[model samples]
Target: MSGDSTESDVAQETTDDDGPKTHSTSFKIARALFGGVLAFTALDNFRKLDEMIAFADSEGAPAAERSVPAISGSLLFGGLGIAAWKLPRLAAGAVATFFVAITPVMHDFWSRDDDEEKEQHAIHFLKNAALLGGALAFLRVAQDD
Candidate 1:
């Protein structure tokens, strides 16, 4: 029987009679890292709304260009990131893809001349990345629910 029952076969056989195993300790850590980041970011967005708007205005961005857009986007992902708990694989992949696409644009340290300026740029870039990961997690849990 042991020779015939490969891990894949056993996994394929899992059913309602034997519910899914609980999250492992390491998985719990990863989940917390992802979900907590998004949830915290969603909370953080509120504090920065006016400042972000002001920064956009100061930067001479168009009227349509505002922190609100990023905030809303982050919130959507943030909620999704938290939800991603139940659907970790897809959620993780999506977040990684999203971050990869957006990171260079958001965190362009190579172009910025000043060290302080680069530092600031990096911070913003990391924030967006973390949120992306978080949102992935949130969406996963959401999908599961």
Candidate 2:
């Protein structure tokens, strides 16, 4: 019958249309770039490990706690980078969260009195914060779809 032919055509059209697929090429590249940046940061942290430890001690870090942040940061940044390469938005968000939590504590602006030094530090902080913000923004945009 004509009705049966129309129903069959509808069924064939429905079968041709597949469900949503979730691969974003832009997101993948963003993730890899963010991951690479994190990896580089981790490398820089390791390169200045002893200086970091000394600063931690000078700032009254407990002997037991002094090495912990350094060790954790080195590992975390490095690991997050690799993870981001595989899972960009999630990894970027995770890394940014850690940075957001620790940056102020580690670089306490309230304690510094020198204007030039403060300005220099503030500029660097803002730059880093902007980078983190961009990573988070990318994550959000990628997730929205």
Candidate 3:
């Protein structure tokens, strides 16, 4: 066989069922960083459970006592799963749910009367919204994978 034909054959052989193959170093790094951030935040939440609960309570979240642990555990496991690329769709979904659930509850800037507090909450709310969008997109990509 000619060199060009042999090279084409090698490329075809490397293609995955999903599609054409490519190095995934950057993707892997991004996934790990995303997971690491979530995991670290979860650890912090656990370390400050009482404070988290108090903050949740102050924010008027229903069942703050029960929700704190549940959310923290979800964040820890979901983050790890994403990092490991294990059931990443589920992990991304969990993270997305967490963002959706907490956004309005914790950062309801509309409810704040003070301008500074309103702006602060609005910033957090928008940030979480962006994260949620990213998580959802990741979920789609994971599903495709």
Candidate 4:
């Protein structure tokens, strides 16, 4: 073979060396930090299935029991996939979908009558918006890759 490094050789060099590896390591940490929360929340949803369903029903979601579990499962798999860098696009899409679909419906601060309740829901809504932004960013990054 010529002296010119092969793609695998360059990849190996990056992995073996600290310069590029630091960036990679940081990205892995970022993925874990973002995805971990979703995974943990999903597990909590499963653990409190009845409460989740009741909350969904209270929000007037159709078929709360079924939808809750389905969404939770999507979040679980999506989060793990993101952290592991497996099926990244699909995972990011799933996470994005959850935030887009649930945020307005579930955390409708405008619908709340009590000031404190409205503020609480508003906080949740903003948090979900931030999460959705992250998911969309990952989705774009996955597409670029």
lDDT of 1: 0.56
Instruction: List model 2 lDDT by residue over 2-69, tens digit each.
Output: 45547565455334344212234554565566666666666666677777677666655556154545
In model 1, where do residues sit more than 4 Å from their true spots? 1-22, 56-72, 83-102, 122-145
Superposed by TM-score, candidate 3 places the C-alpha of residue 95 at a distance from the truth, in angstroms, of 0.3
RMSD of model 1 against the true structure? 6.5
Return the top candidate by lDDT: 4
Question: How do the predictions measure up, each by TM-score?
Answer: 0.50, 0.59, 0.84, 0.84
Across residues 5-41, which tens digit of lDDT does each residue of candidate 4 receive? 7878766655555644425877789889888989999
Decoy 4 TM-score against native: 0.84
Error of 2 at 129 (Å): 1.8
- What's the CA error at residue 63 for candidate 4, in Å? 1.0
Ranking by TM-score: 4, 3, 2, 1
Worst 10 residues of 3 by lDDT: 14-23
The residue pairs in collision within model 4 are none
Q: In what order do the candidates fall by lDDT, top score first? A: 4, 3, 2, 1
lDDT of 4 at 84: 84
lDDT of model 2, residue 18: 49
Q: What is the alpha-carbon lDDT for the whole of candidate 2?
A: 0.57
